[model samples]
Target: MKHSITMLEKTALAICIFIALIAAAQPELMTEHIQPVVQDILSFLGSGFFLFVNFLLFAVIILSFSPLGGRKIGGEHAKIEYSNFGWFAMLFAAGMGSGLVFWGVAEPALHFMNPPLKQSLYPDRLASSLALTLVNWGAHAWALYAVFGLVLGGLTQYSGNSGDICAPVMSAFGNKLSLRKKRGVVFTIKLIAVFAVFFGVVGTIANSTLLISKGVEIELGITSPLLIGTVIVSVLFVTYTLSAKLGLRRGVQSLSIFNVLLAFSLLIWLLFIVPVAPIMKIALDGTGYYLQLLATGTWQFDSQLNTSTWATHWTYNYYFWWLAWGPFVGVFLANISQGRKVWQFILAVVGIPTCVTIIWFSVFSGAAIEWDKLNQAGILSAIKHDYTQGLFVFFSQLGWQGTILIWSSLLLLLVFVATSADSAILVIRQLVQNQFKNESTLYVWCLALFMCSFALLLQQDEPLNRSIAILGALPFLAVFILQLAGFLKEFVRDLCA
Candidate 1:
């Protein structure tokens, strides 16, 4: 037991160090490379893949109402059920909370200002711009979450095991190795999964830290902002980790509930105080354009005429960003999702919330566009200059009351960032220790915090994007291999059966 514990500690340390080094080396590469590949794969997989998978699982659920996939395997029914509240809460948390909050307003406005290729889709560039935003957020974004959640959740439930979430890929790669002789295969797969998850969690931590810090700096005029922000975030994380260690149902669930309420309040304020009708009109128009584009433009990866620019800026960047998020968020979602059918899981976790996100995008994005239209402030240009300033520009449009609302919303954004970071730290601890119990793992949490701080510090003088890009790229090839193996195995097993 002593030797085993020592080995585990050493392994955890090694993993942390390795991730820190990668983060320090080139942070943007992951978003540049691996993400685009994942997107391409999903484009090929199509949204129907998730819909069909859910339908098949729903049939199975109707037949069994148990954990059995037609008696090939069987277990107890899930303790969790799909409800509107549960669905929305989980979606808000898992969908990168700040992205929705920050981008909800920013993304549509950005698109409206700079329409993507093929402006002819809309009557004018503004309509086309809104449409582009909706397409990216509504279709591509949700499709990823749905596909990953379906596959990960289905496999986890079916196996009735709590091994690393990447185990299903191993099962997919069956016969490629002699499992009897190659125990190292499992270890390697787990290591890769853990590493991929680590990189993702680190990126999330850095992003959240930056956002929260900026929010604080803006709201309070806090000088030495990074120091103040870091200290505050550290305190919050320490408090959360303590609670999480107590238990998931108690600390984690309570925090999640609080986060939801805070975020909801912000949304309500935006919906009511902001011009609702115009936003809805913009959103509807955006959704239409997005859908039309989704049918035709999702797979446009032209390699010849500077496709890299587009891929780097939009497609690949978004793909990598989401991929960077996948393992940590995927594992978190998988853990909470129990006693649920695949179809229900997909709908609740991925489908419905994504629809809600569209509404969010419309409100926030529409508000920004309205501000730009009314004020002629070039909100998009300000965001490009400094994304943080965009919030101030937005607040200015709301007038004096808008200032208060924006401040409150900024606080909410800080909370979202804090909640996301806390959850990520917990998930990383679980990954490092190979356990999911809600126990305080201060060593891992502190180590994660340190690594994030180090990454942030390093970024003061250097570009971290390349490092992120490289670490990010490393996982896609493995995921692709696993995905291919999974498809082949499914085909073969069905044929043989």
Candidate 2:
């Protein structure tokens, strides 16, 4: 089977190769020259990005109840490929699995000590911390993914191709724009989205590898072995690649369900063993505060606080990460989510996962905070020294300390990271390919992405990684605005019909 190359794919691959070469050769140059300037620009516009995410949260809500929501995503003849549980599990696994486990405890812990909303009169740091975690991982972030998914939901029925965000944008306005201009613009935007996803996945793998290595070091007698990390990465790449080869229904779905079960077991365990009344109090108070001030709090920007680092690093960085991931997650969800109405797809993609997110943090982070406050175990203090071991520290404090429990959690996390990587590689393969049947395309991206992740693990430069990611994120945020405009125009026209 011969694969044909197009101008868009060729250009994108060339740019990636060029950047990779330079980054591999001169990591210091990027941190010194490029990162500072990009960081400043993103910090300045951080508040606007926050507000934009909030807007998406409500936009999904409003659109759901509108006439457009009554519309169907596919024709009457469309067929459902996966059951609702299977669909939600697979998409949720792809969308958040690894990162959620990493951040579930760490994010709220970090925010409790060093909060972005420092001057706000919110008493009880515990409640505020959980609320902020919910704010970050809540509806707004998922809604961004849904917006992109909704735009491309109909492509499978109409185009018989892998669902890509560019297809929908081009369909909506291709007739009005010149051929050269439309291709150039759409291709450039997609290239950015692709790179964003590539960096996000690579960074995630590198970070998770470190976390797993730390867990191994803490549990056993070994101390910071590179061989262990390398072995783990090799195993991960091979496992996820094989899983991807099994395809979605069998490989991805099976792993997705396993991880969800694993995570729920831990959550349920924590619910029983941890201080139940206090955690419940944290959940209710935090969620109440978040709901009350969702809109205004998101829009507020106080430069007077002199906590630019907090805003830029925490809130701003999260929004960029979420936006960078939006295109891949959105298209991947849309691909599996045929044979459903527009409203059902939107709610499944956006609403349900969000509810799970709140519950997740309530169990993990909420329990961590309570332990730190009452027991004074200094688990929070220890994390400041080595962030990689944050989860292990939380695990030690968990009421169950059996060898089986500890090892099981670690294995669950390993599978979770693999699921995320394979899902991402599949998304990137579909984005760049012309034929959906070609397994070779999937093989190429899967190996290449694993290689890239290894290279990044060697360099270990946060700024360069973040700078490349922000370059993709900032532009895609702009592109997202354009997509919203195009989608609304077409949606209104359909309403009139």
Candidate 3:
């Protein structure tokens, strides 16, 4: 099979590399100057972000029950390519990534120590902290992916377009432009997609590896961030690159299944040991708080509670992070979800993984809270010092079993990181090459991604790394709105037909 390249692909690749170059050379510029501007922009757009995501969640639910929901993605006769288990596993692994593991213990503890709500009872604060964590990781985040995936799948399978990021953009307005102008638009959007994905994944890599390096030190007593980061990045690059080479079925699918099982095994073990009553209580109450606040309070940044910037720092940052990942995950989901009905796609994408998230966070955070109540270990203090240490600190309270659990978590975290990087490499190839063809360039691209991530690790400042990630994702806000419009236009056309 011959793989042909175009100027569009070249331009996109060039722009991606240039962004990485900027990050590597002028980290201060991004952190010092660009960070404040980006934060303010995100603040201004906060309400819009909340409202859009809320719309997506409700829209997906309504669409799942409406007449359009009955439509099959690749037509009525197309058969499913992946088993239900495989489908769920891959989508969950690809979308959630290591952030779930990285934040499982830390986020809840952080929120508990400094919760958004100022005036609340002790138990209410606990439940509300977990609820806020859920708000970040739960339905709203997945709904963005759910709706975007539906649109991408409809276009790729039903509208006869290639799996390029620009397909939806082109479909939305391509008819109004000339051939030369259309090519320019396609080139521009693909460039933005590549930039968004590269920076977003780089941030993930920096953060996950920071955690993994600390995990290595905990297990093996290797204290050098440089050595640990180098080894982890090298291993991650090789592993994911090999997986990409093996393609989706043999590589990604198998890894995703194993990841989900491993993660759940950890969750189940925690469930058995943690105070079951508290776990259940937090899960129930947290979920209630999440739903109750879904519309009214999820996006609020209260001034009286000294949380005026809390929403800006955490919630808005997360929204942009999800938006940045939307195109990559959307493309990956649409590709795998070829034969499912609209409602099936919506439910599976938005429902199953979200339930898993709520449960995962509840069990882990509930356990941390229970232990903290006893002062078994300074879990909150550890998290306050370095968010990566929360998982290990919480594990330390488990006695002899702590060793085994921490090691198991280390393995799971590594695989989670690998799966994320692997899928990202595959997606970048598809976007740049305009197809899913495997070639030498895939390896080169993987190495480039590693370079970008490695530069972030070299910075060695968590807050700075996070700011860069947010900055990188900022441009995609406009792109997401464009894609949303394109999707609705296409959906309405299909309804009319």
Candidate 4:
């Protein structure tokens, strides 16, 4: 109830600064040491990651349809805080916006040209490619976030004590963990969550800068890293900073609505330009292939699959990326999801967002595939040179309107990044203070985030930033396992009570 900063908060601040400074000082060296470690980690935990994610997807689906789904999140009489559109917009924007834009066209094109499985395995490479893209951005990713959000929201709501990510978990498992051991575990988990958020957000900031700078290059032809970083970072910092200050209800919600609208507009415009029939066909075929192959594809690392290298780079990489972002997005989603029924919450969180993502990728990727059939492979060639160019290249095929489309996309990209950034800053601030509605320390957390992200942007090493994020997530896999346990315990207890 009172605003106070704890020692854990101070430690989180200090650690964020320290990591940022080190990353700035030795980006290459850091990447060199970290990449191999993360590579080995991916190999070791690859199958487990797949299994855990699949379990989450199935658990969410089963629970949504079972008797438990009828339970309201806050309480039966609790007031709905945000309108349905507002809530979905905020969650979708915070969780998936930037990454969706960044990879929308590029990933599908890449997979088409270089199918993860042998070409002999799938006759329709375009469908297979789109299916793989759907797998990455689809229900599985949302299921992970939904599970975490449900656990965090349920424990906090039922126990009536919500602080950092660990507080509710501690409340759930209190009797089992000795006080001394509980303190240690809480510290460890909180620390891991903080670091994971730091790396995850920093990676996003860096990648967003890369893509936005690419847009600038296309329009204005300014290519200096310093100028581009300063311009983009300054604009984003000012934007999200103001948004964070305006608080969640006003700023985040407004930006999210704007973002979702703009995104829909772009999707619609693309629909007109791109061939509609082929896009529809691919969407249906891709959805079918994705559902049919979901089980086997979940375990792409099996010895018989013989696609370890491709799977490791594509499927496994996406799982780890989503895992890294799980807690951050989970916290944001849980905060916004009060007063909804369990079934409604999971359905909206996992189902609706994924449906939107499928349509988005189908439009963008289907266009690229159709174009490649006629353009002598120009779009894929540009994308291969720079993945960020995929969106621009795809737009260029729209004739004279290409320039306007390109600028509109750049605006969409920035807004998406801003929404994600502001939400993350708010969550991190709450984690730092272990309390909600405190604005005194908002700028401190924001500055820390900007520093890390700015440092990475300066380095301009997207791979390095990504590797660090994946590494940050490695420790939290243990936390996720514990969260699953805590959630089940809380759910059963709630039913009995």
Candidate 5:
């Protein structure tokens, strides 16, 4: 059994490397072909049916937390405090930090400039442009996370299984078949988890490296910004991985807390120095539009005359991107979420941070948009040039105080990247150990980090994201299907009983 397990691990690793190679070899073709498939799957799954199911699940959770239903679920008997604030902090760092920090200003401005589908809703480039920004960032994107967390957490805790998040999908196979009876099932689960994490880590490392490289290139005339940035990120990832290998209590948790504090400081700075009234107005209008368009915007996939392109670019791309990050983020979330109830996990992981993200994006991105409108500046043009450069340009427009914002933004970006790296490393450790709380888990995490950084360097223009999208899309669909099946099965069983 031990030898077989070793062989299985080796095979999984080989498959990951092979996929990485293929992605590196044919990025454009791979992206063009694979992205459409991901879009179709996400479109199908993210349609009205999926939305209705998610709403039902949310209602169930709300009811489950009430006094009457809480008693039924043994919520009253539960002894833990649930650490609501800690949960929020961790969830914020895990879910939105990397992407928000990178895209908060850039995304809104991009939408404002291009207007994904060139929809006639915002014929005049007024504050309404901010509405579309909030729509993409706020509602459906976070809704998916909420749904995934609720189902995964509920299944793990309620079913009294091993409490591994990935177990639910695996359990969908049932204990009947001979294949399920063998060790192959365990190997397959581990393999899936491994691939998922690899996909997320590589994409993140590459994107973050790209951002940092661009930042350096703008600040200093570094001709080989990509190479330099890759090396720097590789080094930092190695260091963080070593820290992760040192164990969560000592390394991962500490770093996460620090990252949160840094992010908080940045927010505080923005609020105090930046004008707030415009941001508040933008946020309010954006939130209203988001609510109005939530239902209609989700399924607006028009293939003819380029109507679907916006859905393809904003909604579908966002959906697949989130799905790509799901496995690593899900596994990492599952690990930290012990001793907490499913309801608590769902709310903490998905709800609070989402609200916070809405506010954060509004403040940062909205302020930039407002600044541009007031000054009639070319901030939108900078965003058009490069999404990563937009944030710096927005900061620069803030005057002398802008320097402080730039430095703070840079630091915040680093912290966010580090937090993500730490989590990815931890997830990698968990997969390799095949058990939570292993003493040598940190070592395995560091090794995985090294491998991720290596891939980032070797395959700079690799369609690593395409591979991630494909691999993540499969298990994501599987998990969604299993959750639906489980919900239906439980509903029927309750009806009969």
Candidate 6:
């Protein structure tokens, strides 16, 4: 146990390096051969994959209003550590900020043009764009998170133990195990959990750097976008490292609050500046349409308005991506969520973020869809030609080319990335730390994470990164399901008593 974190790092690092080496040596084989294998695996997971996550969300909804929802995650008398606002800021930034920015402008446009579905249900290009986009970003994603965070927080508060993923499982099933057996179980869970978080963050950092590169080119007109991107990520790594060093309350919380405000400022501007009628109309209609088709499992197979290919690429991939991100996001949520009731945590974790995405997609995607309709600035062509630069291009088209708008956006992205990586660093250290006593483990893992992400950015093998990221979630997903089951069992017993 003393050197468990070191051992975990060695194990995870070896696997990551081994995979990277194989992908590096034969990039084509990896892309051509390995990627299809991954796609096949995802296809095998299929509707079951979609259903499992959706069911988790549904389960959370049922529980949130029951007696379970009134139960406090921490002690009944514990004081809240972070304000609801700050807590939400961290959760949103860490959980889905980068995804929102990347997909916000691009997805609606793509769906508008290609209309991923073969059926005519949502075939109206401009009208249903927000609906198509929101389904992915909305309640389903947050539902997974709320459960994980609640369980983690529950174990921590109930037992006066700072719990890891294995805690709930142990609480449920390890009661008969000897001390040695429990340690073994925890050691094993940490090994997989650490790697899953690593892959997810590295993939996100790599993809986010692409967005930063485009932002630099669009905002500052710098020539070497790649180099600029590297610098930007490096700076973010340094910033988050220091933030991690400050611990949760001071470092991560401050950054989260700032980024949420920054991102919201942009959302407000776009929503207000853009015509009110279309944005409101698209959001209202799209929401109803999305809710109506909630059970269709449109992500599973070929449908009238969509193709199986579209589901495989978007919905299936996102399911894994969100799951992969669970540990990083869950740990952060658990840490900051003390003193909150289960229902409040659910509301904070599931409801607020979902609503934010609805508004965000409504404003951003709605505006882009309107522009595509008007062809006022050829918005569709801009996004089609270069999706990474979509947000910048949208800004340019809207005549918000002022440095204040552009530079502030660049800052907003940076801070969001920083808060995410920083919060994950804090959690990863706790996961891999030596019985939760190791300090140097935090710095070592933090730097190692950014370096891995930096190395992947250099490789620029997005498909491989994305494929492995998707795969990383599979093991973790199995573990989380067990944890959820374990949590429910223990809670029921408590309720009965």
lDDT of each: 0.56, 0.73, 0.80, 0.80, 0.59, 0.74
RMSD of each: 5.7, 2.8, 2.3, 2.3, 4.2, 2.8
- Those runs of model 3 whose alpha carbons end farther than 4 Å from true positions after fitting are 1-4, 120-123, 155-164, 299-306, 435-438
Worst 10 residues of 4 by lDDT: 155-164
Candidate 1: misplaced stretches above 4 Å? 1-9, 18-76, 81-84, 154-164, 179-181, 223-225, 232-236, 301-308, 432-442, 457-470, 487-497
Tell me the tens digit of each residue's lDDT in model 3 across 239-335. 8888988889998998999999999898888777767888899999988888877766654535323556677778778888888888788889878
- Output the lDDT of residue 463, model 1: 21
Ten-residue stretch with the least lDDT total in model 1:
67-76
Model 4 misplaced regions, further than 4 Å: 1-4, 155-164, 176-181, 300-306, 434-438
TM-score of each: 0.79, 0.91, 0.94, 0.94, 0.82, 0.91
Clash count for each candidate, listed in order shown? 24, 0, 0, 0, 1, 8
Candidate 1 total steric clashes: 24
- Per-residue CA lDDT of model 5 for 231-276, tens digit only, reads 6676666657666666566666666677788777778788887789
**Residues 80-191 of candidate 6: C-alpha lDDT, one tens digit per residue:** 8777788777788888887787677788788777776544576555556666676678888888878778777754333434345777878677468899988888787887
For candidate 1, the C-alpha RMSD (Å) to the true structure equals 5.7
Report the backbone clash tally of model 5: 1
Q: Residue 480 of candidate 3: its Cα lDDT?
A: 73
